[model samples]
Target: MNVIIWNCRGASKPSFKKRVRELVQNHNPAILVVMETRVGGDRAREITNLLPFDEAIHTDATSYAGGLWVLWNADRVDITLLSSTEHEIHAKVKVRFTNVSWLLSAVYASPRNAERQILWKNLMNVAELHNLPWVIAGDFNEPLLSEDKFGGRSVSVNRSLLFKECLDKCKMLDFGFAGPRFTWTNRREVQALI
Candidate 1:
């Protein structure tokens, strides 16, 4: 079953709901994750209700910066929450189409370097608990290689190595992507794929 995840930037904006509705109509994902919501409290709940899913889990915004919402169509997917924090939502989801069960971690790693390692630790904890194949997806805020970045202070070798180590320790591998090589851009249009 298809799952759509978006770093929508902010769900509080005027047109966010309409765009999400359109996306839900077009992709029809069994599970939907919206990150960097930039809103919390009852507003986050309102946005979740507006989406086309019967069930949702919300991680409130932290200091008005990062927020996460996980929504799923009850008929297409059954999910059990394993663990969660502001940085990630970890779950075991059973897809009806494939009749398979596995772990899903919807992560929004902190932009702050100091907080990134905590997320890595969280994944290691997840690995310790479940042996199922995993699918971790999000704007991790760190890239795996020098080639994954562009127009930045040369990418951090230390950060990249730490990311690699985390992946190795967790026995996880990149699923790779089919889109433009540069998936993100700066004010100058200099790009990076993370």
Candidate 2:
């Protein structure tokens, strides 16, 4: 079973539904985690209903920023909500017709260093609560290494240090990426990856 996690920036855009539909059609993921929705309330509900997923849970956007939506196909997988904060959604997923069961934490970490520290701590608490095989994925908003970033101020070892410590304590390792060394860029003349 495949899970697709996307930081879509904003879900209120005119093409949001079309883009999501295409992703669903192309990838056919059992679960789709959307971060940074920047929308909530009635509008969020409307959008979720339009999507192809059979079930969904949304962490509403605060003001104009930060929202997370976890959608899944009920026929393909059964998902049980574990807990959630503005920064993450923790759940247990069981694939249909199988004995497989695991924890999935979809994160949308804050850009602020302090807030992200809280996220790390919360994740550690969650880890201690369950021994099931776990998959944690999303936009951490903090690069874990100097090499994970390019073009801009040098990475702050202090921040990366905390992140690394959290990973070590949680016994989690970066899955890394293919295709591009950097998944994000500033898009200006002075481009940086994170």
Best by lDDT: 2
lDDT of 1: 0.86
The alpha-carbon lDDT assigned to residue 86 of candidate 1 equals 89
**What would the per-residue lDDT of candidate 1 be over residues 48-165, giving only the tens digit for each residue?**
8877789998888998899988899988888999888989999999987676998999999999987899999888878888789899988898988887877658888898889888
> What does candidate 2's lDDT look like per residue over 1-194, in tens digits?
77898889999999999998999889899999999999887888899998999999888888879999999999999999989988899999999999999999999998888999999999889878889999999888888878777877889999999998889888998887767666567676653332
Among all candidates shown, the one with the greatest TM-score: 2
Model 1: CA > 4 A from native: 97-99, 189-194
Quality of model 2 by C-alpha lDDT: 0.89
Task: Give each model a TM-score.
Answer: 0.91, 0.93
Mark the regions of model 2 whose C-alpha exceeds 4 Å error after superposition. Answer: 190-194
